[model samples]
Target: MAIDQEILEVSSMFRLLMKKASQDWNRGACKMNLTFPQVQILYSLNNRGSLKVSELADALNLTSAAITGLTDKLCSLNYVERERATDDRRVVYVKITKEGIHAIDSVKEIYREMMEKMFNQLSKEDIQHLMRIFAQMLVNIDN
Candidate 1:
């Protein structure tokens, strides 16, 4: 297969778009005291209900100690709590508290507005096309 200028241009544009979108997301995330990992811990807890520290650390690709530190801070702030499993005393689960939920939800509105701004110039069809392209790309990469 031969490369084409159009393909190269589109690929570059896609990379730049992804970069810009990530930057905006980081900016919104920066408003909170949490780093990306800390915020991600909250996201994981919210999504998964509750999980052991090792499990959360594995999901986030961090060491248990690193997650322990983040969880400690979150615990001190009352954003999350450590619980002992009733069935297994040795197992511990971390759950996001109401404060954690509120903190994450508060940033969502602004971040969503940022997403809207990024897509405001595009028509509905364009947005749909972009979604299709992204979905296909995920399939290709994930496999």
Candidate 2:
């Protein structure tokens, strides 16, 4: 079977764009002053709401101890609150406060704008094609 050069070209282009997207996230987000892990926790809370440390760690694929450590740091900074369940009294849940919500909301726009600007550099048709391709990839991964 003959290899398609155009297929290889698009694959390389996808890889390059993915690399650039990751790099741009690291660079522009550092200016926002939150580490990537912190951002992940806050974003998780924003989306999932109150969850125990174990749950958060499970969701993030980190150890419970690591999640406890992260939550402690966030707690000290007043970004999150740890509350013992009234019924269980043994289980504790990490809850996002208004500050944490604010922190998450704070970064949402900058990240979106950064990527939007990058995508805007492409032609509208190219952007639409890329979006559909990535959406299919996501569906494949989810399934």
Candidate 3:
């Protein structure tokens, strides 16, 4: 195939992959009653511990207002808690609760199932090669 044709095919495949992944993810997330962004916030908090609203917004590439709305819902669900910083009364931090950790564990299982279903046909070596290719693509894009 010509380089242009190859590029078009790759782009098409990438879009299809993303669409399928999103659909699968949505179904899984729906079972847990969480949106993708909500899960992202939970995952971030799980990994990074507590963070300020602005910090979470920056880390997640979302606006502070958006983070606040999401965190509000999360707090209502008892998945996370917002606490005022002791040293700085004006600063608030969001921390994941035990419920949030449980939610993340469930999400991890969903992800594992999704990945297995997606790549079950591929051998271990094939999966490794795919990861390497994706990593290189990311590096190239960064440059």
Candidate ranking (TM-score, best to worst): 3, 1, 2
TM-score of each candidate? 0.79, 0.76, 0.91
> What does candidate 1's lDDT look like per residue over 41-93, in tens digits?
98899889999988998899998889899999889878899999999998788
Put down candidate 2 lDDT per residue, 46-108, tens digits, no spaces: 999999888998899999888888888788878899999899987889999998898788789
The clash tally of candidate 2 reads: 0
Residue range 120-140, candidate 3, lDDT tens digits: 999999999999999999999
- The candidate that wins on TM-score is 3
In order of lDDT, best first, we have 3, 1, 2
**Where does candidate 2 stray beyond 4 Å?**
1-8, 136-143
Q: Pull out the clashing pairs in model 1.
A: none
Model 1 weakest 10-residue run by lDDT: 103-112
Query: How far off is residue 30 in model 2, in Å?
Result: 1.6
Q: Please count the clashing residue pairs in each candidate, in the order shown.
A: 0, 0, 0
